[model samples]
Target: MLGLSAFLESGRGDKLSSPVKQFIQNLLKANMEGPYGSEWPAEEKVKRREMVAPEARYVFVRIASLGEFLTTSEREKTAASCVEERGPIVGFVHFRFVIEEELPVLYVYELQLEPRVQGKGLGKFLMQLIELIACKNHMGAVVLTVQKANSAAMNFYLYKMRYVTSTISPSRVDPLIGIEKSYEILCKTFSNEAKAILEEPLELVHSV
Candidate 1:
């Protein structure tokens, strides 16, 4: 069975081959069509390729064949060798390390899974892996933006994963004022310093 350890990581400035880029594009188009496409125009959706090309780094989960797995050292020999030959990518998570509200965080730009792979606990495992990466890198939190129209994602993050709407997030600051936004920012904090920044009421923080 394919496991989390089998997934391959891609980082900044890594030139993804055409097949890999296509794999990512297909997943993004399929997953974001419902809410994001509705909110943004068709042209904007098409333009996402250009936008996503530069900033995104990825963890790619590809299909593994029975009794054909290679050791991690062997897999690193080639860029795409770790991925299955002529097989569809199972899923990918795009993220970057950045500073938000003056705190360092691992910011998840996108997470997409094929319909066939949904509900197999892979998503949760990927999230746990990212959180571990964040802690190891001394990041204060893990953060992501979710479209308000995507109730499934909202429920998954807020209810199942215990992520909270960040204190400085527009919606958390003032729902009425922030309702103009199409997305909500959420975070899972790992440090007391980060929790203090993200969990306190904005008014209280300002008053102090």
Candidate 2:
């Protein structure tokens, strides 16, 4: 993946400052509220709780002026200067490493981007970095939830990124229930067991 050249900065959720936290909330609301619709209130509550989890991890994309690069490497290069130099937080991915159906996985909880940055290839770059992280940690797979209503995001993951709707996704397990659900679980597996458990449909898993 042609990445950020170290422009992407990562940190723990617990270390996020008040201003950074506020940026996340505003960005999430701006980027996701529409797809969630009336479920936004409940989903927002869930998001708030998840964002502060002690183990949660983040990849923050800071504001780089039109022709300038913003990061510790390019800026003053001190911990404090990195924070003070980068203009603002414009995008971020919140994720965690956790056990899912007995398999260790990297779960992406949120991927939010500012509207102005939407078509600039940053989203795909971030996902590639996330997948690389999963592989480095020997995670069996990288998993995420995508709203059915968010067609752009759905396309980006399912088609562009080659992620599949996981077998555990509501629709895959039970079509009837899936019809009523708003989101789908998607995964990219690195092992056969994970492929069977997460990528194969429930019926196929039962037969095998």
User: Which number leads on lDDT?
Assistant: 2
Mind giving the per-residue lDDT tens digits that candidate 2 earns over 150-206?
999999999999999998899888899999999999999999999988887557767
Q: Give the per-residue lDDT of model 1 (tens digit) for 95-183.
A: 88889889999999888887555666777888898999999999999999898888989999998888998987787788797898888
lDDT of each: 0.73, 0.83
Question: Each candidate: RMSD to true structure?
Answer: 6.6, 5.3
Candidate 2: list runs displaced more than 4 Å.
Answer: 1-6, 67-83, 201-208
Q: Per-prediction TM-score, please?
A: 0.78, 0.86
**Model 1 residue pairs with clashes:** none
Candidate 2 TM-score, true structure as reference = 0.86
Give candidate 1 regions above 4 Å deviation: 1-6, 11-14, 42-55, 65-87, 201-208
